[model samples]
Target chain A: MPNASEPPTTSPGIVRRFWWRSGQRTRLAVACAGVLGALAVTGAAGFSGDARLAERGGPGVAVHRGDSFEVTVRAVSGVDLFEGVEPGTGRVFGARVAGVSAAPCWQSQSLAVAENLLRGKKVRLIVKKDGDTGTDRLLVDVELPDGTDYARTVVDEGTASADVAARGELGPVESAARLQRRGLWAGGCTGYRDDALAPPSSTPQTSSTTAVPTTTTTTPPPVPTTTTEEPAPEPPPTATEEPGDDEWLARFEGKRCLLEGTRRTSPKGTEIVCTRGPRGQLRWQRAD
Target chain B: MRTEDHVDLFAEAVEADPAPTRVDGGRPRGLTAEGWVRTTGWLQVGDHPVSSVLLAAVAGLLWALVGAAALVTEFPVAAGVLTLTTPVVSGVLWWLFTTRLRPASTARNVDTCRADELEPGDTIRLHGSIGPIGQVVEVALDDDARVVLHGGARRTWARDDVVHLAELLR
Candidate 1:
């Protein structure tokens, strides 16, 4: 009874003091977090700023000595990464790729632009330092609108993945046989390293005879055109029209080189366009 | 998943893309455009991984325990050393946290080939209306039956001639 009478009105003070002690640890932790956070902010700002500065290529696009590369700097939908040459040349740069001038990546230095391009997008920049081959290497860097950038080392030949990336087999067997007779690419794609190619081709499947669509023969009837509308003043070319591989081959034969070099696509697949370069100078562009 | 370490590494196979570009239709390209490859392989550092990160954390924990034991009592002189080490350990832990938090599973465009589709291996022709978006590739083998190729289907098909489908279906 006597002990119960007074467990100390001060017991509340002990509890409060305990809480204060606990609170001190939490406050210390919060303070540490705040300091660390500020340090992190400063560190990140300094680091990212340095990276950006490095990216700008203040030294101004220093290439090797004489490296020539094929490139396609154009307007990609409303997001071009090039500016027209104010040095008084019509040659468009990456800033114009998206068809606008303010693509954040459009650095005036040729080297800096080379350092920033999308994977498949093309731009011709030469790495000419002093002694490297004039056409030393092809390089491109791309920065997506969302602050992500990608780079690709352009190869001398489109052979990094496959010696022959061209699609479609001999249009018809007889045509394939003719190609065999010509021994295209050491008898055509059959020459790609058997081991390098997945599921190695063992017997070299040769299709000297034509095989029609065995999957399903639902060839739609040819739709004839009436040419009802008036043609535009200067119609764009019809490079993308679908045709048989043999037909394409025929056209390709007439045009040994694609005239225009390669095809490119924006990340969103919003659009794709064709481009070409001769000895690394961007020469043509098509949207078909 | 370590069991898959030595397996065919399609785990890192990026979305499929066709090399020789073609136009499908008014907006059509060949089925090859929507082509893809299956693979399995090691992911790059800063990429996306679960087991590797966990293993790192575990290893760090062991080192931290050793560090703590060294700084207690007899080595109170090294307590400052331990304090300095804490943040270095903390930085690594933070990076691991960030890696887990911000992984590189970014969405990318890709396409693939299938068996018994319009571009069947035996056949070289694929006649179908690829859905407006390159997402729903409806290769119509028959009017009532349109085989749908989904996922990565972004390519320009310029030629719709009869061609081999087997090449892309690997």
Candidate 2:
């Protein structure tokens, strides 16, 4: 037994002090564990079965659609797991890496690459409004500390393929990776490997295919009709057509105009008709 | 001897030796000259009351139990409600601990030293929840004082609250 008056400084004293301190420490630990466990349970349940795909339409694990925030990588999944407090609201959110398409076979290696390059490092994410192909996963462009593009790096190293529809600028880098047989391009991953050999134009098929036929059918007839009808009245401007100047002037005819740091407003409900002279100087004409 | 007579004798002895003396031989191993001892109590460094800890634990366990029940009953709506309430519940518990459950100092025998005896840059501990070590940044002639505590955050306190002042042992 210890003396009552003596200061408790022995090993037993230290143990007693720790025991008293444990109450507060245990409370803090339980609080944190409780919250985290709740999140884990809910997250698991949310992603269960067919509801997993539907949950993608809801807010993401770390971010919502169109959220731009800075995050630090906590763990690496197929994409990096990042956490940051949302600006203006101070609400905490997690964000996964966006704009890279890692094939299923290459996910583990891609995750390894993400860990090697981004683990415990700060990165900025610009969340895209369109959700990822993976149900409910946020699409974000992960930028490294020194402004290196995470998706471009992944594609350049052949760890993942460039998401052409989402990240068009990475097409050239993806081609380079394929030519060098890097990453998934190394002959075994058939889907992305074949994509590398196809022309970059093939990826924009949805928009480009529709646009090409419409423009070809409608554009030629209008040019001849406009040239013939307006030839005499608009001689000075038509003489210096300069290819598409007529269409260019026509686009802004009825719009509010800004020129040389001046706002040009028409009080009489008039249109600003613009023309290019022979020397390429712009002439603004007001028409009511 | 009568109890009053014994108290008078002890008071006279204390006044005779105003300066603190070392105990045992060369300064007691853990007790500072200012009388700070490393231990957990109502006034210990970074210690929360056991009651506060119990309160937080109960709150957490309640959240977990309700969340589990919501999942079991196939009540996604209830689960969602519980999920949204978790942070608010934790924040309320933290506020309760800080504002209501924190201990107050009732120590009648609080040791004190004169402001003149302590110089600028002396380490000290305040008497309240602002515990856990601070350095005296300034000491004014009129008993006005300033201390730089945790993370260079400065605070002002009266001369009476300056409970312990001593050189920090390296």
lDDT of 2 by residue, A65-92 (tens): 6766676555565644444443443333
Candidate 1 lDDT by residue in tens digits, A1-288: 000010111132443323222332453465356555654564565445434433432212223434444434333322223321213222223222211121122122222323233323443443323322112221223333333321111111111121222211212222222222221112223323223223112212222212212232232111111122332123233553234444434433323221133333222222222244454533223334
True contacts kept of each: 0.00, 0.00
Off by over 4 Å in 1: A1-22, A54-119, A122-126, A130-253, A256-288, B1-170
Query: Residue by residue across B1-170, what tens digits does model 2's lDDT show?
Result: 23854555334343311222122223322333333322112222222223333444455556655555535334456666665665467656654544345311111123346444455545444332212233454445455555443223455556564345432221
TM-score of each: 0.18, 0.29
Cα displacement (angstroms), candidate 2, residue A217, comes to 45
For every candidate, what is the interface RMSD in angstroms? 30.9, 13.1
DockQ in order:
0.00, 0.02
Stretches of candidate 2 exceeding 4 Å from the true structure: A1-66, A80-92, A130-136, A188-192, A196-288, B1-170
| Candidate 2 C-alpha error for residue A43, in Å | 22
Maximum-lDDT candidate: 2
